[model samples]
Target chain A: MAASALSPIRIDDPADPRIAGFVSIKERDLTGRQGRFIAEGTVVLRMLAAAHHAGRGLAAEAILLLESRVAGVEAIVREFPAEVPVYVAAAPVFDAIAGFNMHRGVLALGRRDGVSGRDALIASLPASSLVLAACGISNHDNMGSLFRNAAAFGVDAVLMDETSCDPMYRKAIRVSVGSVLTVPFAREGSAASLIERLQHEGFAIWGLSPAGETDIGGIPPAARTALLVGTEGEGLPPAILESVRTARIRQRPGLDSLNVSMAAGIALHQVALINDRI
Target chain B: MAASALSPIRIDDPADPRIAGFVSIKERDLTGRQGRFIAEGTVVLRMLAAAHHAGRGLAAEAILLLESRVAGVEAIVREFPAEVPVYVAAAPVFDAIAGFNMHRGVLALGRRDGVSGRDALIASLPASSLVLAACGISNHDNMGSLFRNAAAFGVDAVLMDETSCDPMYRKAIRVSVGSVLTVPFAREGSAASLIERLQHEGFAIWGLSPAGETDIGGIPPAARTALLVGTEGEGLPPAILESVRTARIRQRPGLDSLNVSMAAGIALHQVALINDRI
Candidate 1:
């Protein structure tokens, strides 16, 4: 529990160049990032530290905390690698640097392994695994909730296509309660290739739809099952539905469908229960 | 589908006083209201329209639609009562009136059956019913998703404690895809009284938790069941958990719990399936 890994740096000026990566987070989230993303709140920061501690393809470069929060979170902060810098600033200075009021008072800068990092990570999962895949999930909250569900159900990894929102988006990471850091995820390629690669990996691909021939409840347990979900409005693309085995959640008729994240949660829970992984 | 019930009204000025209720919507949501809330997006507007048509205690007093969207939604417009006015405005004008960019171009001034309306509605549900009880669900998204799941699982009603967020909140209604209008809900009294009243009415209350003894999969079907969910993080208050028969949606150890909405979906689906209602 010793905090040997971090020497708290005092930042008095919000304009200090050292903390520029966190400036104007909302705008930066819209435009792509330069391989860096913000992880907000204490939970997410801990996840980043844990991932870094485990060498699970994500590392924390720095942490910024409101001066008052430092005392409360010091024990957790000490767990990060010694090389990772920790900075503390007054509330005003921290708000100035962040370009908004950050009530959580804890933020971390996370760096993924590389562009192809998630793909390589996915290729390394064990034979018995559960994965939650996102095809066109662009909403940050949906992206985070999906990961949180995946983690709760013990899914091995989360695979996302280019159309999906970044799992590291600050809002997403916060919404996931830092599950984005705990759950492994990769965002690469088109939906077609993502599906093809999973099938080639000896995984059974089950795309969730409202009109599947068989309900998700009856999808007999399997060793490696990849549950595919699409964006909210239009569900999984026609190509993916036709190419993979599609299963419906059996929601009552009349309503369109459940929210994408909720659907994933239900489907993942069923899969985990069926496989006795829970 | 004839729209003889609704007559189109043309609006050229953004500050036509007729649309003041929608101005500065974000702030208005926090302050008080005159039994009115803004319903945005086509899906929610349609729900409002349906509620009005069915005399379900909700009515559309007026509609502010972008002139361009009028033709596309003509079929839906005709479903409303002829007294409900449909106001068409230029996008710029609508944005000015709303004090923000109204991208969806469909906004309706909805008049609910007042605070006591939903309470009376909830009291009127049948002897055999499936209801969703929200104790401390304060998040708008979670509230909306709960309503959406209730609709999907054929839950008869969504009853919220006074601490819960307003289901009529614009974002919640949109997230629920207008299910907030279709499904009956009442946010009144304390969680204790709400549960007591449901118990008095024959509801077998099942509080969802991560530490419960009975697994959600094992919850046998009943004539009347009320699934209770609390806010994220704090979960259901200890008082409620101890008083009711709690059940857990089994998940892997170490993880805290599933998202509130996700848990509701899984539990509702399980209960619905057990009852042979789905």
Candidate 2:
């Protein structure tokens, strides 16, 4: 399953600048690259390859695999274009380069082509589309889980505020199970701007909060719907909640709100128009 | 809010035997206590205190709080009966005791009163109740997230497989946001046995797998239903999937499957009789 036009490169030096993107992964996680992200594990690597092949602006600049793991992922690695280099490192060198155990044995550096274009993406949604928008979702795992839910319900796109965490964060991508690689997302503008823009596009924006006025289950379906999710503890802000229709998942009282990702999934499933999706 | 009957004792040494349960917190996370578990944060502490007051097995043995955070959580501490000791530690001492930076600044040693009784809990379920059964869920966070969803949807109880991770795992409890404290669970039998028992109890046993033969949304609501969620990759095993009524959350074809917790939430929202719950 090896690619004929390109052969795997051997990475031996821990200080090699060619592998700079993969070094100190924990620290790099805190400070992301210009427009690049790391996709770890076999599943996420495959997703990166798929996104690269789809010509969707995501490109695999290079791939680093454990010497022992190459055979297992040969088919997936072969799917990448010949120009993308696959680097194989001995287990010890790989771990040293990554600054951790790096047990998953697979890592790929992926770069998104361009800058944020929230308004353009908002303006481009077709009529009768389902979208998920988030405000102040600063947690990486939460953002990743949200993307996974959005993808499962066939959300057309995920829109987040400037304050939201990057969907490309490594932990977020891992938690998403590579859904971050598959789903399209835009992170720009304020939460209010996203709501106003969706409303302008004739999309019904529903803010999901525990104190919402309407039950999410019975909310009437609309042609184009946007499910708005917020951070776990402090849900959609008051002005944002009041700016759009607010709906709460029907749940037992006395406890705090549902975890944000669970709430997103429930809300998405309700308004997702399943027949059109699956 | 200074629990008049009990006073907070100042703790200066991390090596004190009185707080043995709280030391080596990380290692203790892997190897659990005989019947004790640590509950962190103000929210979980409140739940543990509530469970203690209700005399439902869970009792707060002792508490450790950062000196700075003691005042903010005094109301919750006072809720605990006078018998439970409250310990205050300087910030440095508390962090040293936890083996990490303990930012939330609250930890309580909670003890379950007795051993596992899976059959007893199943027997006690109301004629019309929603339940969640987990099979092969080894990941602590997933178990924790499942419990959180169960609590949010008002599930009567969570019955897990013998192989599933313990809900009382420190990370699991924290991820569950103390739902593990409030929600009752039993992990005593094989997944097949759990399913079989639920079926015998006149409950609708639905195995949630991506390969499920039935669509989750259109399934008619039942007086009682049990939603089964398996591990992330290899979902409900073949025999178990075949043994119960199989239902799939409709999703786009290209993706593999939804995160188990998200799937559980979506499925529970559809099958749960929300109006009757709250």
Candidate 3:
């Protein structure tokens, strides 16, 4: 059986050709990673395995782990198909290959495949749904937090503009707690174009901003709604805010605004509650 | 003329005696800070100056700057009394002293003074007020986010248990965007004792947990309301949850809980809105 065929291979050398994809992970995170990404730690590894088993268009190509963690992760590793290789290395070799001290000591190489186009993802959602659309979300932490919040609130899908950072980035996936692996998402086109598509599908769009005209609480629940958020300092551009219904979360005067991800989480909770999704 | 007396001092050595407080900042952040904290970046530096001028019990003992940034922050440095020395160093010396590449080029030594006692802080609130109470928030980033949410929602004061991390930690202060300076807060004592004092003040306490009996939205606005939140994974202890009125933010079934800071922000916004504070 495929399950019985699983045996972790030992890696003594950091420069082994078989583990090339796992070398200098920190550097790979910055330079273009093509369609491949890294999933770190046990929690994310389990999520990757689950996604793979469910045929969610995310595949685990291979895994590299510290020798000590091999026994602990044996069950999770068994979930993957036999074709997937699991490499175990001592701390010295693992750290050398990663080019940094990897405290978690678990890593998996994943490839993005069969992801839906923006149009198809939007069209696939039910008539009544909650969506989070992000624009110019350049920071990976905020992007990850956004995905985590979306999963917690049962968001049908997350849409990002071309300027948004890739959700598949290692830090983003880790921050999302692997939500990026399970949640349906698409990133492409301009913010305005994405908004136009949602509007055509009879979705009520609410752009979050400090200067929004209507208070966020005052936004009535609708059949289908999209909570739109933007980058930290330069919020949704003037044109995008003007294109959609904008709402503000009232706050004390003179203080800097809430972190963008926190603001979005608050807004999503309210919308999800009123829409009865949670 | 204190303003004219404020002259920038140039330091050629990383081991300069005058700037002793700013040396090995990263190391100091983990070890004891002796009531002293570092404020970084232009935004936080401005806030520190404002706190000093307002006599809010936070004083800037010294200022350190990269030689290149001295010109830009001269105005802010002038806000401090002449007794507060402003030291300028080249990138190499500054980086060596900081034990890391100091990207923002601004740092200030601040001392906390006249911070309110738990009883004094609770008793000082008006008859009708909103407050945020945190229990076991050990993460610096989460601690900072809690304070930011408190300030945004106009919470009267923030109360933390002994187990919670210090809000004055350098990273905490930076993450809070200086909210830790302006907000009225007290962190000491056990979580149970702190909550008892709030109850004595006739404050309605709502402990947030996923298993909470009441939906957060269902919480009625009261004259004196305090929203209590716990750490990320092992949420509020059962004893605490059983003691207070419990509320939960309804969410999807299978996903991990929201980030502690994000969850607190959502609940705070709800309470603040119902109380007409926002």
Instruction: Give the least accurate 10-residue stretch of model 3 chain B, judged by summed lDDT.
Output: B1-10
lDDT of each: 0.83, 0.84, 0.89
Enumerate residue pairs that collide in model 2: none
The ten-residue window of minimal lDDT in model 2 chain B covers B1-10
lDDT of 2 by residue, A1-278 (tens): 44323368888998888888888886788887888888999888889889998876789999998888888888899889888888889988999988887449899998987643888877777777889999999888889889888887888889999999988888899888898888888998899888889998998888999888888766677778888988768888888988998998888788888888888888787776532555
- Per-residue lDDT over B1-278 for candidate 1, one digit per residue giving the tens place of the 0 to 100 score: 23323446777887788777667786787765667878888778777888888876688888888877887777777778777778888877878877776448888888886444545756788877999998878788888888899999989989988888888877788888889888888888899988888888888999998877689888878889999999877899888999899999887677657778888899999999888778
* Candidate 3 per-residue lDDT over residues B55-90, each given as its tens digit: 867999999989878777778887788899888888
TM-score each candidate.
0.95, 0.96, 0.94
Sliding window of 10 residues with minimal summed lDDT for model 2 chain A: A1-10
- Report the C-alpha lDDT of model 1 over A160-210, residue by residue, as the tens digit: 898887788888888888888787778888889888888888889899999
DockQ for all models, in order? 0.80, 0.75, 0.82
CAPRI grade, predicted model 2? medium
List ranges where model 2 is wrong by over 4 Å.
Answer: A1-6, B1-6
